[model samples]
Target: MKKTILITGAGTGIGKDAAFALALRGHRVLATTQTEAQSDVLRIEATNRNVVLEIFKLDITLEADREAIAAYPIDVLLNNAGMGESGSLAEVDMQRVRQIFEVNLFATLALTQVALRGMIAREKGTVLFVSSIAGRVPMPFLMPYSMSKFALSAAGAGLRAEMDQLKKNIQIALIEPGAIHTGFNQAMTNSKYQWMNASSYFAHQAEAMKKKERATFKFLEARSTQGIVNQIVKAAEASRPKLRYVSPWIQGFGIRLARIFGV
Candidate 1:
């Protein structure tokens, strides 16, 4: 069935890929970006690709932008707009942590709430949260971003159950993408260095940490987003989506194994 899907952060990476993919599949895609420039760029890209898309600016953190969701009778809401910050939680700026939460958790929920009201009244809808594998595991230095995703994953699970109990036919699912080479991983891993300095706690080992992160991503990051984008398409199109959709499978399996062994 053709569905009207609203996706946040459709400017680039997974969100952008998924938007184009969905539109090409004949779904009505409202591809929203954080800034007007991104919206314009996306519009042009859609035209260039010869796929139809409704491109618009929707910074999820803003109330006005979030309120605009109510104007569309969206069949699916894909919360993919999120920010990342890396630092030791002990010394990381509290404001930065809060900002991460604001974008990844609070704003996401706020927009979801707006979409849910319409979904509930209509008696059917789906919500997909783009979380991370890091949310399932404790990632040192990436705690700020991981912490928000953890909360988001939890919220998605709980909401799925709530919807079931209400018998509204609403579906909720989490899309946990592993290290995909979307540049997002690289930027997130390098974020800590932005605030780190000689006086910082991990200053002495900074260079080693950088090398380790670079090596880790080179080894683990998937060179393309197709694996995860496939998962997103599956979840979005399924009549009864699973509670969690993860890709690449091997990375997710490794995370599960690590969790089981308390590693």
Candidate 2:
């Protein structure tokens, strides 16, 4: 069954790839980017790929940008838009953490609420939150981003249960993807260094931590984005979508093992 799916942050990374993949599957995909330049690039890319996509600018944090979703009769709301903040919990700036929450949680929830209104009126829809595996396991220096994702995981679980109780056919799924080579991870890790210095308390450990962080992504981050895109499409089309879709199976499996072993 073809459906109209609205996705945020579709200008690049996993969201961009997923938009094309879903469109190829014959779904009407509204791929929204954070900026007009990104939207233009997306339009050109879609044209080059010979895939049809409704490309537009949508900064998740802006009210006007979010209000645009109301114009679409969306069957699925794919919340793939998110930001990353990497720093030590003890010394990291709280303002950055707050900013992280604004985009990853508050704004995300607000938009989801909007989608829920329409879906509830019709009583059938799917909502997929693109969370991260770091949300489940604590990754050093990535607390700000992880904290938001953890909240997202909780939101997904709690929302799904509420809908189930209400007997609504609406579905909510959390895409907990492991590290993927989307450049986001590298930029996130490197960001801390841009502001860190001798004035910092963790100054001594910062360099070593940065090295470890890069090494981790080099070895663990998947070289391909397909793993995540596949899960997104599955969640979108599932009759009874699962609560969680953790990708790069090995990473997900490892995380599960760590949990069982109490790591």
Candidate 3:
């Protein structure tokens, strides 16, 4: 059935792809970007590709933008706007760590609560969180961001159960994508270099760490986002969606293995 869906961070990456995919499937998609420029670019891209969706600017971190979602009577809320930070806990800026939580968790959770108000009032709706496999497995140098996702994963699970107990037909799901070549992961690791230096404890192996980071994504990051977007679409439409929807089954399996081995 066609539904009104609202997606954050829809100008790029998996969010952008999923917006187009969902809209092409005949869903009413309100695809929001972080900036007006992004919205403009998305408009052009959508027109060029003949994708149907309403593009707008919405920074989830901002109250005004978040309020706009409530006006839409949305049937599905896709939380995809998030930031990433990387650095050793001891060396990484504490402020950066806090900021990571602000964007990746606090804002997301708050927005979920907002969306829930409408959903709960109607007693029907779906909330899909775009979390990461990093939430399940510990990746070095990416601890701060991972920490946020850990909380996010927990939030989604707990909220899902909470709504279930209320006997509401509300559905909640987490879309965990691992190492997709969205340039976001690259920026995540690279962000560390901006503040990291020889004085840092890991200074001795800084270059090596950088090389390993690049190699990690180069080898693991999927070249295309088709599979990732497919999972998003699946979660969006599933009547009784699973708790977690992970893309690139192999990567998901790797996460399971790491958890089993206590990695």
Best by lDDT: 1
The digit string of per-residue lDDT tens for model 1 on 1-263 reads 99999999999999999999999899999999999999998888888989999999999999999998899999999999988899899899999899999999999999999999999999999999999998999899999998999999999999999999999989999999999988887898788888899989999999998999999999999999999999999999999999999999999999999999996
Local error of candidate 2 at 124, Å?
Answer: 0.9
What C-alpha lDDT do the candidate models reach, one value each?
0.94, 0.91, 0.91
TM-score of 3: 0.98
TM-score of each: 0.99, 0.97, 0.98
- RMSD to the hidden true structure, all candidates: 0.7, 1.0, 0.9
Q: Which ten-residue region of model 2 has the weakest summed lDDT?
A: 133-142
lDDT, candidate 1, equals: 0.94
Model 1, backbone clash pairs (residues 3+ apart or across chains), number: 0
lDDT of the structure predicted as candidate 3: 0.91
Cα error of candidate 2 at position 122, Å: 1.2
Candidate achieving higher TM-score, 2 or 3: 3
Model 3 agreement with the true structure over 202-233: per-residue lDDT tens digits: 88898888898889889999999999899888
User: Considering only N, C-alpha and C atoms within 3 Å, which residue pairs clash in candidate 3?
Assistant: none
Error of 3 at 157 (Å): 0.2
- Segments in model 2 whose C-alpha atoms lie over 4 Å from true places: none
